[model samples]
Target: MQLFYQNLLPEINYLDQDESKHCIKVLRKQQGDELDIIDGKGTFYKAKITDASAKKCRFEIISTTQERKVAFHRHLAIAPTKNMDKMEWLVEKATEMGIDEISFFQSFHSERKVIKIERLEKKAISAMKQSLKAKKPLLNEIIPYKQFLKETDVSNKLIAYVDFKNKIHMKNELSHQQDTLVLIGPEGDFTPEEVSLAIENRYKKVSLGNSRLRTETAALAAVHLMNLAME
Candidate 1:
């Protein structure tokens, strides 16, 4: 089923400007037409269009359903890559695979110091609609690496690091049915001091795999692993 997103649902029954245009002008939806809407907070609504205005198409709710609760929550924290396209790709794929939250941080070896959270959020919204997911992953702005390490609280905390002898795979480290957060470093990888600090904060050092992966790839891999653990 095709789904339109409008975070404000039962409270305010109208699509935003962009969504309104798509529903009316692009898709040619008319008054009395039925459509599915998601609030991006695990709620889905079945509604009938009341006004087909291209600027603010309004709808009346027919029914509402909440998304099924997952066995575990997956949160991925990573350093944004130097290339914006790569980061966008990561967000899109991770959303499709059912990530709960994504956090970005600036590390000592981070190549990209700044990121546009709004753009990434748009990508996530599109991916959620495409994948027929009712919930949208929370996209957080870039913060200091140390700050994230200190503030993050989850049942299972992991840091993807390059350590030949560490030998602990991320998949093996994850505990079933627990909220997990994995940290992926930047292109240049995390500094030793940063890894040490994360360990001090109770983040376990884990390896994604034998082969070295890019920052975005590592983050997606972590998300994928977390999803698998839930299954």
Candidate 2:
């Protein structure tokens, strides 16, 4: 089933401009037509369109229900790549693969320090609808690497780095049905000092694979492995 996103849902009673345009102009949806909507809060609704205008289309809710969250929450925090397109692609694929949350961090060797997460959020929303998922992954604003490391709280914390001595893989490290947070660094990779600090602060120093990966690749690998652990 095709799904649309309008988080406020029956309370707001309408799709925002972008969603309205797609529903009215692009998809040619009309008044009295039924559509599925997700609030990104795990609630899904069946609604009948009240007005199919090219902008600010309105809908009335027929039903609403919440989906069960995944057995485990997979949160990935990564340093943004210099080319923002790669980051965008990562968000799209991660959403399709079902991540619970994503974050950006500005590390010492980060090639890109800032990301326009609004665009990334849109990509995520589109992916969620395309995947027909009822839950939306949380997109976080970019924060200082050190600050993010300090403030993050989760059941499990791991840093996927280029460490040969620390040879444990992510799939082996992740526990079943537990909230897990994994950190992936930039292209130049996380500094040795930062790795030391993360290890000190209870972040496991783990490795993704034998071959090295790009920033986005490593992040996605971590997400994939964590999801695999529960299977």
Candidate 3:
């Protein structure tokens, strides 16, 4: 079943303009038609259209369901790519693979130090609905790499770096069913000094594989490893 995403639902019995357009004009949903909507906070809702104008389709909530959280939660913190399309693709695929949180960091060698958080969020929402996932991953605004490492804390902390010195594979380092945070660096990869700082800040150095991957590819690999460990 196709699902619609709206952060807040049926508060005043309406969908926002974008969703309304899709429901009315695009899908041709009309009054008394039923559809599923997700609030992106773990709830799936059943609603029936009350008014089906192309600009403001209104609905009445018939029922609500709280989706169960997975035993494992995956949080990925990576440097944003210089190309927005790559980053957007990463967000889409990672969400479909079942990630819980995403953060963008600007590393010392980061080619791109900024990102459009709103645009990233929109893609994530679309992915969540397309994947039929009730829980939405939390996407953080871009922040400095060191700052993010210093501030964030979780049970398991890992950094994917290709210095070839650490030799610890991310797949080997992962502990099943636990909250894991993996950091994927920028295009040129994290500087030796930055990697050292991450180690100093309690992040265990790990590697994805011997085959060198792109920024987005490495991030998606880490995310996949995270999900695979749980399975």
lDDT of each: 0.90, 0.88, 0.88
Candidate maximizing lDDT: 1
**lDDT, model 2, position 164:** 69
Residue 224, candidate 1: C-alpha displacement in angstroms = 0.7
Candidate 1 residue 59 Cα shift, in angstroms, is: 0.7
**lDDT score at residue 16, model 2, on the 0-100 scale:** 89
How well does each candidate superpose onto the true structure, as a TM-score?
0.97, 0.95, 0.95
**Model 3: per-residue lDDT, tens digit, 1-231?**
979877876465688899899999889998999989998889899999999988878889999988877887789999888999999999999999989999998888888888998888889999999999888899999999878987999888999886655688899988656789999988888888998898888889898888989999999999999888877
The TM-score obtained by model 1 is 0.97
lDDT of 2: 0.88
Off by over 4 Å in 2: none
lDDT tens per residue, model 1, 1-231: 889999877789899999999899999999999999999999999999999999999999999999998887789998988899999999999999989999999999888889999999999999999999999999888999988887889978999997877879988987667889999988888889998999888989999888878788888888889888877
Candidate 2 residue pairs that clash: none
Q: What is the lDDT of candidate 1?
A: 0.90
Q: Which residue segments of model 3 deviate by more than 4 Å? A: 10-12
TM-score top scorer = 1
